[model samples]
Target chain A: MALENVALEHVPSGYGVYVGFFRDVTNADFLHQQLLSRNRDFEYAFIDASSVISRLHLLSAVYSALNTLLVGALRTPNVHSEIVTSFNTNNNIADAYRRWGITPGKTKDLIVVKIISPTAEGQNGFSATSARTPEAIWAHLTEHVMGKPVPVTDSEIAQATDWPKVRKYYRLNGVPALEKVADKAEHQRKMEQLAIMGMALRGL
Target chain B: MAVPHQQQHQFPLPQILTHPSSSPALLITQGAEGRLYKTTHLFPDRPCALKYRPSKPYRHPILDARLTKARIAAEAKVLERCWREGVPVPAVYAMDAANGWLMMEWIEGVPVRQAINEYLGSGESQEGQEEAEELGDLMRRIGRVVGALHKTGVVHGDLTTSNMMLRRQEGEQKGVLGGEVVLIDFGLAMQSMSDEDRAVDLYVLERAFASTHPRAEKLFGMILEEYGKSFKKATSVLTKLEDVRMRGRKRSMLG
Candidate 1:
């Protein structure tokens, strides 16, 4: 229950994607420092859950980043950074990190994504096994991240979602499409769809 | 003898579809600009239409890549714009314009061309007034969609029955010429606010509707009537459409 090894469709079997959700995260400043210092152990995309609309929204970004990585066109430093940048609807990496990435004191609920590449140790040339196992990643996350581990489901993510931030980030506010939806659940679904579309169509 | 099905497709697939997935990708249709494939690449339960514009061999490699990328980006941008404006168009799921592929929500139901043809072909005798009313309603739906699209400041350059889909409603009983009208195929679409561009769009559709559904060409006026009432400036576009009908989709150069 600590980490989920998402079996995303169309992704190459060589790569592994694991996601974890933590609520009421307290050691965000310490964790944020690890990312800033370039610690090898912290090679993960730490996202602020408030900006995420749903599991599909998060996975869309992951898929986009994975696609970019597969084609050898990753603009960010690594696949993890690319995943964070994939959440933005523009080419501003710095703004994406600040808005979606983990920030000290501000981000209460956190979403962490770790991408294990097959070619981790490039010297060996395309290793058959993933660089890290899901169990080890889960254990490390539970030990380090000071928060309650929650399942990465839509309902749970919805609890942490900040609608205002999401609306601003995806330009979902005042969208004619959403205004036409009357049902509450349908409205949320439409918002999620719009956000996913925004991320998919990033950078024009 | 490993995966012999890969050889079935007439053309080589894009790089993205070659990866393994729960369900096999099926080539749905092929157009001059690109090919459409139905694949569950985003989610196993969700299907998406993947439009891929393969590079041309005649053009230089760099030029072909640039053109393909630009077309994919332009198509995706227009789709997103229409979708945000509540226009009945497929929402973009994912796209890699640089890779010359765009993934969009797979619209269910037949193309408007097929539905209208089926309705018109069902009887040698004239369709009853009730049935005629049903077809008129569909035309109005088309009008509203095209009007909404134009109101969003984008013109669907390729306006034809084939480019529009009638989305099947879940609980509604299946019937010819039923369901919501969803516009598709925006490869030639562009953002424009000019009445001239909008008029040319309607003119193209009027010509296409006449040829594609000649039996029911008279009903085309219903579409224009609804379109005229849809937006603030639609009246002007319809007026311009009359001139376009006379000039034959191009401005005359007579001095």
Candidate 2:
């Protein structure tokens, strides 16, 4: 149910992160409110799982958020909020929330992320300095989330993804290189590439 | 690394990399148009080339921004076209035309110029017939790539040996010209089906080879041979190339 903090390769040192997937998240509204109210105690970035296509799709957003956080260029209130917005294709913060952020009763399966670096303490919050161990984060998430944690693997993420919505969100439909691939798996891989590119090029 | 807070800054960086969380971006080159940097696209594991066109100090601010933005957009568009057509160019992963940076797939390889020069200067049994054969293959590979680009209706405006790269092959040793040719530095690239444009592209490289590596210039005929066999319309382009050669590298204003 839990894995050690995952250190992304080639990233600046000391930035490890833990991702959790959950199905049947009944308390998404409550979690979503905590974010709307900007409650520091519930500090995890709660993403709507169905919007996520794969581990890389989710991690790509996290990596962009962290990179922005380091450079002091965060658009949202904090890195966690910035992570929620990073998955978006534009700088529209509220639209990003509606698209990828949890919608209480609407978001059934959930993707919860907690960055494990001292710098993630953001501008204001629960002084994440002392209680950021992987175990501590898992215990806190399970206690509040009220959903069973699933491993954040590629297949698991795929199971929760809404492909049609994914295509619409990332503008992947009708892409020539994407449609050229007949094989299903190969096609999905190409779509993911374009999707990630869309996210990366948002401001450009 | 071009850290923003460094004691002695060489040049101003794009606003994207100014954050404390901004990953390190290393300047790869500074052409007259702009500077290129090697950095991650989003995730650290995913490396990308960032081409940034800084505002020209001499030009009017409005005109400078317009030119920079248009160039970035045009470059990204051509790269995307080539990628979709399977023309063996770097994929345009993302681009911010307004910011003057186009993030593209980071191609890994040495420049064709460096590889050719290294082999020519290797002095390892220069008398061996195998060396000439190996060099001939390299030239053919370069021609094929150029042919592929032109076939896709794109003319690489600045076609020098440096813009052509030889991607390192698995288990292949270096200094042998044993790699696939990949094009780079499309800052001046454009999409055109014109025979004149394609011919001029070939002529530019012809001049580059003769001046840069006189020893390898004799083998460039092999490039044309391979190019002529690449596409249905390439022969006509090659015919145009002979005319281009007679007219010299400089195009006539009256034409």
Candidate 3:
């Protein structure tokens, strides 16, 4: 099969893929061979930039929509964590552009594909989609896929309790762990309430 | 910086009164805060004053530490500020805020109130009539210093002659002539722009004069007139002073 026709699956969404184009098959082969000789795992293909662009086009559209959604979600009150995750994911996509050699003045066209994976703890499951460009990848993540729920760690539970010692003990570095510890502490603290209830029940 | 001259005194408490090896001066002043001692420079033989803020039992340890640190810092800052403004106050030598003590220059003179009283009452032994005339000039200088202090926005909350020092210049041929008036003890000084506070300062001094020195009214009048010349803002204060004198600082039922 031709390199342009080859498709790799399971790439995470919001991640950028770079495809370098050569003028002819011989030139492309020569470049690929040279890269392979220097280092292991060198992979290249003969394809026009337009072919890669077509494949990523749908992915780009989805990313753009997702980016808009994420921005809106961030603007909402108390969605700071969502905003941070979105921004960080977008930054990763931008870095992919640099890796592809897609310069402003370069005559060679390079295609970048972005793959965004819903976070593991997020309610939505993983979905693979192609992005034609970096911007398109951003849109897909923000518009289509709902944000994944962040995992709660022990440290987060400790922090929420405002008991620094307990938080430190759990080694939880995020909000969820702190919340967990606070909930546990609060439940344990309800012993007083239970005692009061028992006293009222005894009188009844 | 010039290493101040060393002064020596024989003190009973070695820890409280440390003698610089060069000078044998003993520092001896006791207060609620701590004990103070006078000493001389170890190398230069210049006079220096030492203040030791003692620990208080009434205050919690943390609060005492905070208070001692703040008081020492404030006192040092006030002295430096006053010195920069050409106020004849003591130059700080060393400070131990944690210990609640500050060491400054040991003023080599009698307290102004003591000098004034000695001259006005005894007038026989110290320097004869010449000394009495000199006391007049010294009193006027005291007034000028007070005016200067007020002009600089510093209200010496407790303005008493005992807080003023009349230092005779060292090695002078003439006896007790050309004495410099120095102000001391800034434990309660606060920065203010209020004329009322300034007036109250003058009133305190006036009362101090009446109670301490004989025929103080006449002498204080001379000081007041000189003070008026020193500060153009003194007129209104002097006017209010007359009213204060009448009211006697006690509220009447008529009000």
Candidate 4:
């Protein structure tokens, strides 16, 4: 379950995704250091889970990154990093990474995303089957990440969400219709819709 | 789907669509001016309506680009305005004027035309007084939506039943048209403050009703009555509508 990824039918054929939700992450500092050191092996996106609202919120970012990759319109360095930045409303690359990406002592609950796509001929030094196997990917993640891997479900995701931060990040306070929904669950659903739509229309 | 205007001589595609996947923009309409496609804006989870004004082969390149850019920009601006003013319309999600594509929120529902036809076909008259009152309620909702739109200082240039949708409510039974009214297809919409423009909007809708649902045409007055209660300016707009109807939607040049 940890290594096996979901394949979106509408996406280009080459890409596969592996996702995990972790409750207690203690090695964020080490992970951050690896990213800073440009360790090619540590290319997974380590999202600060508290900032994430739901599975859709996280997947929306993935969708944007993959769409950008398919068209070669990537705004960040790579598809992995772009998912980290896609949550923010604008294109301030550094701001998005700092706000949503992992921090050394600050992040506890964490969401990990690994995107494995076929590299073009003679590009990036990857062979045709480099990222196709789930076993190798799962073993590597388990060895590196210091947390118990869990399924990406709404109930689990909700436990990690910081509502105030999510609201401010998505500018939900400014929307009148959103403010009018009195039901708590209904309000959350509306907020998710608005947030996803907000990301889709980013830079517009 | 109609043949995409983007044929072999397709102009270079927009930078927004990075992947060269075979045209995933599913064509939804082939109107006189442009084609509408249902596609994702930035991700597969997000479904959006992409309206593309294909460069006309009959016109020069420069002229075609100018017109397409202007139309997309204009339509985008109007949609934004309607959304900000809380009018029930599809939100403008994204736009690439230079590429002639405008992405909008994909609204879900049946077109009011189909809903009305089904209601009338169901022999609404025999369904008791409750059905008739419910139909009136739906008409008033439409009137209120249009009133809100006009109050925002814009005019829907082409007012037709097909352009308005009746969003089916959750767990709603079939053939019972009730829910919010969402106005769509703002390609011809433009900024206008004139009572004449507002009146003409009503006249066109009235004509649409007369042509398609003559039996339901009697309920047209209920729409006006409700519109007058929507906004302060609605009274004058409804009054102008009567004058416009009397003149058959044309003013004499003799004056």
Candidate 5:
């Protein structure tokens, strides 16, 4: 019921981006299994919420993946998987999966991102009407994923963040630009900037 | 045979910009290598500048792709390096090097060139004690930013007042020269540790500063004075700048 229909700037209107967050997820294994089995119904980016920094950070990855899909330059099997890969600061896809992807037990909090674009629906051989509405997607997620649904907001995302893991993943430890910042909010802002920059300059 | 004048002058939007958005992407400027668009990044509230490099019709497809990709990647890399070192520059938002487009944070305020001209043109007399001090401060900020850039082992190949933006400070009064000096246009930037490269960068800025702000050319020394104090190796770079100034931007014209 907490699934939010997110609207990204510059993204085509036909592309529907729906996001949902869950805390203390109990059925991560089942969701992980569905992803591994390539279940058509489970075509969502199941991200470990702990590794994410904030709403902006999550949206940036989604934007990058969506852009890749638009340009027909997807490196992963699908745009869902590409979202996870876009979080990486390098080209190693497996590393990205291990770091940001949902694990069976380690992923306590979960962020599910469903991108319903024209290409995805057409390629999946589903008519526009039959290709999963936001309500249908929410119904399916609530019935399957066992967790406490939370609004996908910055405050909620901040609670689930593991700073140590994020620092290691984004290489934000002891950065001179960050070290010099004395204010807490400014520090976090700079960290987010650096992390986004890391993702933008990936493979370069 | 008669296409409307407005339609005739309008260039085709890049493939990315063809997508629907909250607002229409406005073409800000067109350069020889690329075009800049004032657009949004991820959210409509976050405005960003999107630089798009269109493919050249003259070059072979393969070579053109390679050159475009390499240049975009190089510029992004240099921008990232400068950002990490705390150099006042626009943070890159997103990029598709292969697609020849880079999105960066939109800096607010006028170009340094425009700011200087406005200050100088305010009064008929050349010398105003208060205005001179304000201009001196702006020059120091520019020098410090350039020095910090060099310390990070990057050389901005093109250094001009037009390439630098005067970002307004938070809660600061509008139309004042006091603000952060953010360098932009890294299309020709590169990573280098050589004194010659650093000196050449300074020399280019000096030449550009003189031409752009001829009335305030005497204030150029304030920039160098701040540059010398910005880093440890700045003195040596300044010494090398004299040699560069004598022979001009070219060492020996082999090209």
Candidate 6:
């Protein structure tokens, strides 16, 4: 079946999942409200494949040289456009969810997978799934699709493998590690080194 | 004793009036030029805005003086023209171009950008979708003001939300007829009959709207529609505006 033809049907009756299709996320108010009327605490998600790839590419480059090498190997001349196409085709959805640690089944009561168009014009597309435990899916993505080690770093392991510290950290930071700064001094040091190295390599 | 109107004279650093008796009670120091003080005149029993354009260290003293004088004269001329043309701009009360200081009627109201944002409900969580139409209407009015300014050969160089003030009308003045929309800060304003200058002014405004307001395209479209209807000469200007929008404000070397 064509990917665009993939409709959200797995969601249970009486509950409606409204997907906002927009070129930009700023114009998703009407769609947000439409879903809100059906469910008071409707889940809000922004899945921009291009933005996701851009962020992942940036993070992959920053995190580890191995991941950067892997990404570089996988990347083509039109890597962004290729990833966008794959994402639109629903081929990369599971991998994307695993990368972000977003468990679809965990929030079956709410909406999921709100894909936004990768253009200047605001267009939104949405999808839903059945209420099944996403552990197997997550395991498959981590073990197979990623082809990289599960709980890639000690921090990820600490957050996913160890929940207490994660909860504590969230309580302290008011958001997850992904949102807030983990170590500002470390980040700053790395940034300075990168700058100096960049300047040196350019013979500046 | 009436304050003496100083002629084209030597540039001097403006003295900061701190005393409430001598200056206005509330002095807000905000703006690119320098410190902007909102002060009142006891003799006239009216409030006024005092903009003190600080001396630039980069330029030579002679060049700085000449530029300052030219800018002050240009601003005063534009404001006078706007006033005569029934444009809602601040009335220029006093100006010492030599010292890079301009005193004008202090407008008491929130900025139109702030008002529109507040009306639209800006925060971590959105709240005011119902007032979007009203906000749209106000945005169009601002566009009309810009269009009118362009028609009269004046360009508000820095056409941003912060520069536009929306004064609330007093009791029994609750409607549109009661309240006033006054354009302020003519420090960077210039007189230009060229469409390129006007297009750049509009481009600046468009960029400002995009940065300041969420979903500003629809709002800006409404503004453009109202602005287009304000003046007959605006058609050619609007067409040039499209070209400016396409190429952007910066001139491309390729062209």
**Compared with the true structure, what per-residue lDDT tens digits does model 2 show for residues A1-204?**
564465663455666677887888888878888877867777778899899988878887887787667556667777777889999877889999899999866899898887666554643433444347778777778888877777888988888899888989987766667655779988887778777766765744
- First chain TM-score in every candidate? 0.94, 0.92, 0.18, 0.91, 0.95, 0.18
Top model number, DockQ: 1
> Model 3 misses residue A146 by how many Å?
70
List ranges where model 4 is wrong by over 4 Å: A121-132, B1-28, B33-109, B126-132, B150-157, B174-176, B188-200, B239-255
Error of 3 at A197 (Å): 68
Query: TM-score for each prediction?
Result: 0.95, 0.74, 0.48, 0.78, 0.95, 0.48
Candidate 3 regions with alpha-carbon error over 4 angstroms: A1-204, B1-25, B41-44, B123-133, B173-177, B247-255
Decreasing DockQ order of the candidates: 1, 5, 2, 4, 3, 6
Candidate 5 lDDT by residue in tens digits, A165-198: 9999998887878877889999999999999999
Quote the lDDT for A172 in model 3.
25
lDDT tens digits by residue: candidate 3, B1-255: 554433333323433233224434444667766566666422234567766666667999999889877877677667655654657788654443554656577788888777666656674435556654776677688889988887777888789988898777867643332478889888778787576677778888889888877565567887788878887788777887777677765435694
Q: How much does each candidate deviate at the interface, measured as C-alpha RMSD after superposition? A: 1.0, 5.2, 35.6, 4.9, 1.0, 30.6
| Of candidates 6 and 4, the better by lDDT | 4
For model 2, the docking class works out as: incorrect
Write down the lDDT of every candidate, Cα atoms only. Answer: 0.88, 0.79, 0.49, 0.78, 0.89, 0.48
Off by over 4 Å in 2: A1-19, A24-53, A62-108, A113-146, A151-191, A201-204, B1-9, B15-25, B40-47, B92-95, B124-128
Per-residue lDDT for B1-255 in model 6, tens only?
564223322344255332213332344754566667666432234577777777789989999888876777677667766754657787664444665766666788888777766655545224466355556667677878888888888988888888888887566444331246788888788888787888788788888888887665567877788888888877677889889989888877893
Q: Write the per-residue lDDT of candidate 3 for residues A80-163, one digit (tens) a residue.
A: 112212212123433322222222332133222222333432213222233434355435323332222121222322222323
Per-residue lDDT of model 4, residues A1-204, tens digit only: 565476653465677788877778889999899888867777788899998988877887886677666656677777878899888877788888888899999888888888877666325422343334677767777887898787888898898888898888888777765666689998787677677656755554
TM-score of chain B of each: 0.94, 0.92, 0.81, 0.88, 0.93, 0.82
Q: Enumerate the candidates' DockQ scores in order.
A: 0.80, 0.21, 0.01, 0.14, 0.78, 0.00
